[model samples]
Target: MKTFFSLLQKKLFAENAPLVMLVGLCPLLIASKTLISGLVMAAAISSVLIFSCVVISLVRKLIPDNVRLVAYMIIIATLVSVAEIMIRAYLPTHYVNLGIYIPIIASAGIVFAQADNVASKNGIVVSVIDGTLTAITFSIVIITVSFLRELLGSGTILSHRMIEEEYGMSFALSGGGGLVILGMLAAVVKKINSIKKSKKEGE
Candidate 1:
């Protein structure tokens, strides 16, 4: 249990998916205009990633070594399709907002890469943990950007209207999306460098 928690923390924070691995940037950038949207997309994508990884891991042995990539893609697509259906039935609003991006999760290179590189070779328990960690990492980065951008650009958080109604900017489609992503990327990189320097000093 201690080792599991340690691995989880490292994957979720020290080696975050979006900030460190830099995966799932498309929906991350697009849905970050509002904290609500970013959170919704993150949840959806994370669920898909976890499910896909589990399914792929289960079938890994059956897949021929040479055709493993194709097998993984098919499994990912199937899981993403199921995710879309479940989300549409239960979270209609999020389903609509996420739109085409939800399906794009199937095509996300991160999904296939994780399956092919880590999950396939690992046991079920480890694969599931890795998937959950990767998903959390992806969510943290995108949601952090969304939080900052929504607060700074529109003075709102999670669409709760933190700033005065008259004072806040409109939640238009393209508002601060690119700028927020760039700023977050820069900030994350700087933070990583600072951490490395601190580690070296400690050493």
Candidate 2:
């Protein structure tokens, strides 16, 4: 139990999904123009992550070591398809806004990477916790970036329109916002590395 909590903290906040591990950049960049979009994307990714982790962990013993990559991809792609269909049916607007990007999320390096690196080596319980933490961390970073972009680019908070019209600038939703998000991602990675270094020094 304590180990589970430790791994969760590492994956969620300490390591982070997008920031630390640099996974799932597709929706992170394209769908993050607004907080709503980012949050929705996060939910989709997290669902996929948790479900895939559970499935993979349960069947790990049956999977041949050499062909694990293929096994993992097949599982992830299936889950992503399920997510895509559900999203299209339940949230047509968000589905269209996200478009092809949602499906491609299965192709995101993070999912396969986690499956290969962590899930393959660990037991089901640890794998589930890791996957959930990674997904949550990813959601937080992308949501934070999207929130900033929406506010600065459109002077609106989740379309609530916070900034005065005069202060409103047009660059928020533009390609510039994407670049800013990337920069923020880099900064986050740097911070994590710094913390890791400090911890090493203390040890």
Candidate 3:
């Protein structure tokens, strides 16, 4: 329990997949145009990442180094397909809203990188823990981004009308705006990390 909490903190801050590592940015930006859409994307990605990591870890020994990347891609692609189908069959509303973006998880660099760096080298338990923490941290970041975007761009949150539509700035909801926000977020996190590093060094 202590270890899980510690790792969760690390993934959430020190090694955030989106804000820090910059993985899964495409979906993070597009699907996160709305809070609910971000939720859909985050859930789908969490499922795929967790499942792929476990499978890869379980069969790590059988995979050859020469073809490891190819094998990892196949595993991730297959898991993403499963997640997509599940989302489509049950969450038709989100499926309509998020359409093609859910399938993009298979191509996300973070998933493959985790599979190679953590899963392929670690046991199933460790891989599952890592995947779960990564997913949780990722979900938090995307939801935060989307909520801010929705509030700023649409002047509403989940259509709750935080402000009048007339008052809203369309730019906040656009791709360029998302990039600017993401870049800003990345810079803030980097600054915080640098300060912490300096403080530790000084100590």
Q: In terms of TM-score, how similar is model 2 to the real structure?
A: 0.87
Off by over 4 Å in 1: 165-176, 179-186, 197-201
**Superior candidate under lDDT, 1 versus 3:** 3
Across 1-203, the per-residue lDDT of candidate 3 in tens digits comes to 89779778778778988888878888899898989898888888888889988899999999889999999999999998898899989999988888788888888887887898899999999899999998898898889889989999999888899898798889989999999888888888888788878998999
Q: How many backbone clashes does candidate 2 have?
A: 1
- Flag the better candidate by TM-score, 2 or 3: 3
Q: Per-residue lDDT of 70-166 in model 2, one digit per residue for the tens?
A: 8899999999999999999999999888889999888898788888887888888888878887887788778888888888877888889798867
Give the CA lDDT, 0 to 100, for residue 15 in model 1: 64
lDDT of 1 by residue, 25-56 (tens): 67777777778878877887788788877787
lDDT of each: 0.76, 0.83, 0.88
Worst 10 residues of 3 by lDDT: 4-13
Residue 36, model 3: lDDT of: 88
Question: In model 3, which runs have C-alpha deviations exceeding 4 angstroms?
Answer: none
